[model samples]
Target: ARVAGFGPDTVLLMVLPLAHNYNLGSPGMLGAIAAGGHMVIAPRGDASTVFSLVENERVTCIPAAVPLVVNWLNDPALDRFDTRSLTLVQNGGARLSPELRDRLRKRLGCQYQEVYGTAEGLLNLTRLNDDDEKILTSSGAPICDDDEIKVVDEDGREVADGERGELVTRGPYTIAGYYNAPAINARAFTADGFYRMGDIVVKRGRYVWADGRKGDLINRGGEKINIDEVENLMLKHPALHSVALVAMPDPVYGERACAFGVLRAGATLTFEELSRFLLEQGIAKFKLPERLEIVPEFPVSGAGKILRRTLREIIEAKLAAERSQSAGPRRGP
Candidate 1:
């Protein structure tokens, strides 16, 4: 409620289900009671419906998921509606790609706030007046002054500022246990009690930016590849609407990176063009995607996070089929 800038005159719009525990709705349903505001729940979670509600109700703020934002950006009718009343658009429940964030800023012409949170409890947010670099780069500072956080290496030793490591936290509101799962809880929490977020991140002062999950890495031979880093660069290609980088099995290298891109409306991009763009971005030769798959949309988890595992499976199956075809039909005894 405090971080959302909710007040007596604020008009907050809710597009996701009320059951969703996004930071925008910690309690009191968009903090209407906590801060004294008006909350408008959308009847249908569609772009047109959302735009209409925002325009009619004079919605000042909306806390939404990545997919809703993507649909709004790609919708042709977007310009026809008036969203000038919007003061802020908060995105969470999934990563906000650089390209998507830029588009949202330009299209809505409002403050775009990003947050990192989970159902288990920790929350980080970029303030409405934060500098462009902080808002666009780091995930922002913790919501509470006493929220204890630590970035540590694989050995559980705290890493230096700006060094990539896993983020662990134990705070006033953060849960100490996960109900009845003792076996799972043992590995999920540290010996002393901090909850292991399993998120690879870089911390500087109170600001932290997540790279991806600890297991979300690919090893191309002996070289370690950060999938999110490569995907961020690939997303800059003009023809892509969204990009997902995942691993595909290889006989020699063990695993290789493959890119899956959803094309922008009326925009087509070839693998050669994308590769050239990534190279021009100054990425290393080893980070270039070995294979490209163009799709209409990438699979997403129930929480709206991109399901890279599903994408990896898709690409690996495709490779297997290609290999089988190349070898031709086998003789049957």
Candidate 2:
């Protein structure tokens, strides 16, 4: 409608990948069209182009990823654009760190909302009304509104509040069965019908909080270490640039924590230094990595995710050689 000279409120801007649910401008445009609103599609979204569209088109709402929104707020060219027209800005994709979320809320003065969803089925959203604490703490409540969420243990019973368990959700709109795959359907659903999310969640008050995936949890001996917590804490180190924590097979402990990370330019760091730092910060010794691999760069997927599975394979191969060399030749006579 902007192309046809429609009013400002009639426009909605999408800055994410069009193929993504957040940016495709499908459901968002649907609401806009019903209200006679216009949808402005950004073929390629960047900090410069996005803010320009917001100012020129008077775009009121934007559904974007957290990293993109952070880039916009920190952009040196922010003064060049007039974004007073923006009322709602939503962010998703990954777990938004508490520090970044607070900066966006307090420093940037934007209405920051957090959303949690999977490409397949389950979707949850955190309302804007919640304080920054809630926004960063919980992944928010179920989006289905009336959906039932239960955190269950191996015995298939609901665990007590704050205890971690596999998340099982049941709702009307939830996908009842996988399409054209009996094998998936068999493992994806519970005997009683709730969808097995595979990811773990904890109940805090009334909200169900995501604890990453079930398989991703690192078991160091008898202790279970949350990789997200460790990764978040590692990122707090000033010398560190990026970090990905993956479980490496261990003979004595079943599986141990291994962190693959990059350091800031011209900054020299060591596993010894990191171990002391984490211990000083009150992180448990078991959670401190048994091995730290310093890499120049991480291997990221097309979607910009650090492929942990790939990284694990590389780490395994390197460690195997080290162990074999230490053991020496069996040898002899």
Candidate 3:
């Protein structure tokens, strides 16, 4: 409640399920309850519903996924709503694009905070008073005084500040181990008992900067293409409302980065055009999206986080079908 700025006067917008992690999801509902605040629950994140609730209920804060806010900002009817009531928009579950963050500040007149958390109970929050640079670049510091965290390299050695390494943490709120999952628990927890978060990050003092999941890093012919960096650069393109990058199977490299995008209204984007734009932004050639898949919306989990695995599955299916056709139905003769 304190970190998210919820209080008796707070009117939070609840577009996500209560089952979402008690750490950062549930629209700050747990904090709202602790602080004696009011909540407005909406069935969906449709622009009409969100805008209406913000106006009618005078919602003061919203803890939401990155995609929901992008949809709200791109809606043509946004200007029609009186959303001056919004004071804060806390982004979690995904990395928010830099371009979208600037747009939200100008258009909505609210503060933006980035959060890093998981069902395992680690939480990092950007303070409301953090400078523009800190809020824009790092994911913020630990929310609890008892939360113990560290960054370490491949050999289980701790890394210095600003050096990238895997984040491992354990705290009063963090679970000791998964329920009855010995195989996973053995690999998931450290010898010293820290829970391996499986995320690559850089720590400076108490603040953290996420570099995407270790598993999600695309290896193209042994060259690593960090999807988060590529996706942030791609968001600057005029036609994309939002973009997510995931690995697609390649015969030679074994894996290649492919981008999945949701387009802005009336916007048309082709692979060549986006390629040119990214190159203009100075991304290396290997990191270029080998293909683009446009979707009405990205597949989301119950807690409203993007299902990147599902995105990978979509491209794999398409490639399998292509290879089957190229093989001419396995030569029935």
Candidate 4:
């Protein structure tokens, strides 16, 4: 509210899940009511409905995660709607791709801001006025002025700027320790009293860009989906020796889970069968694998740890090829 250009007339529309940490979906509703501006709630995020709400309600601002924005941009129906009232779009939770950011900025004629935050009390934001490169490239600086951050190696020693390390933070609002797990608490906090974020980050210029978390958790729509837990269930397929879960680029969900695996010799099973097998396990629908590929082997490094990022790249390349072929023009007229 104290921002120069923002005022009582700013209408905020929120469609993110209300229960998720980033939800503040309704907090915007409260802000709108206090400022005497209309608050619009989108129970579910659909492109057509969102565009309609924007036009009908003259929505001036939108709070969304990267996935929602990607889906909206890809939807062909977006061209049929009017969204001129949209002036500002706030994207947070995960990194927004440059392609998506440019599409929204050019097509929507709005300023886009990228924010990085965690339910655990870490927050960073890229200003709207920042260059498109920075907005798309970096997570920007700390939100609160007093927030202090450091990137440290395994020994708890600070690393030089531009080097990748685990991000540890100290701030007034930062959590001091885990609630009841003393074991987790000991590892999650440093002896020097900084909360060990376990997030990989790098310093470039004056901003910090979050790479990914140290733990192999799949961040889908702000919800932490444990990959190992899911992979264990997938291996029960009998035809599969072992499986590794990797995140694939998703225009709608920010990232969707994809499984890469080695099938048992002489075993022939379709993806549908594998999916049904997982469904029977009663995992949350969102946690189910959206795409699955059978590979001869899993990539392993010198230390024998699975190279998940390498597998993710291989799956992404295959998916991209399929999409490109599908979108390719029809044959000779």
Determine which window of 10 residues in candidate 4 has minimal summed lDDT.
22-31
Weakest ten-residue segment in model 2 by summed lDDT: 1-10
Compared with the true structure, what per-residue lDDT tens digits does model 1 show for residues 1-333?
A: 677677887888877776778834543265765787878888866778998998999998888777778778878877877999998888887668766777899899988888886678888888878898877766778899988899988889999999999999999999999889999899889998999998898999888888878778888998989987897788677787777888899999998889999998889888898889899999999989998899989787544668888998898889989999999999899
Question: How much is 148 displaced in model 1, in angstroms?
Answer: 0.3
Question: How well is each residue in 1-333 modelled by candidate 4, as lDDT tens digits?
Answer: 222124577877777755555445223454456666666787567788888888889988887765467557656778887888888786765555555667678889888776676667767777656776777667777766777798988788889999978888888888888778899878878887788877788876557877667756677887767674577578567787556788887877778888877776688778788889988988888898888788876765431346788988898899889999999977886
After superposition, the stretches of candidate 2 with alpha carbons farther than 4 Å from their true spots are 1-15, 22-89, 302-304, 321-333
Q: What are the lDDT scores of the predictions, listed in order?
A: 0.83, 0.73, 0.86, 0.73
Candidate 4 residue runs with Cα over 4 Å from true position: 1-6, 25-38, 216-333
Residues 1-333 of candidate 3: C-alpha lDDT, one tens digit per residue = 788788899998888666677333422777888899888988778888888899999999887878788888888778888989999988888877667777887888999988887878888888989998777778888899999999999999999998999999999988999889999999999998899999999999988989999999999999988888998998888899888999999999999989999998899999999999999999999999999999998988876678999999999999999998888855556
Please give the RMSD to the true structure for each candidate, in Å. 1.9, 4.6, 1.8, 15.8
Instruction: Please give each candidate's TM-score.
Output: 0.93, 0.81, 0.95, 0.63
Poorest 10 consecutive residues by lDDT, candidate 1:
23-32
User: Where is the poorest 10-residue window by lDDT in model 3?
Assistant: 18-27
Candidate 2 per-residue C-alpha lDDT over 205-317 given as tens digits, one digit per residue, 9 for 90 to 100: 55767778888889888799999888878877878766778999999999999988877667777899888888888898889988899998777543334678898899789
Clashes of each: 0, 1, 0, 0
**Candidate 2 CA-lDDT value:** 0.73
Displacement of the residue 26 alpha carbon in candidate 2, Å:
10
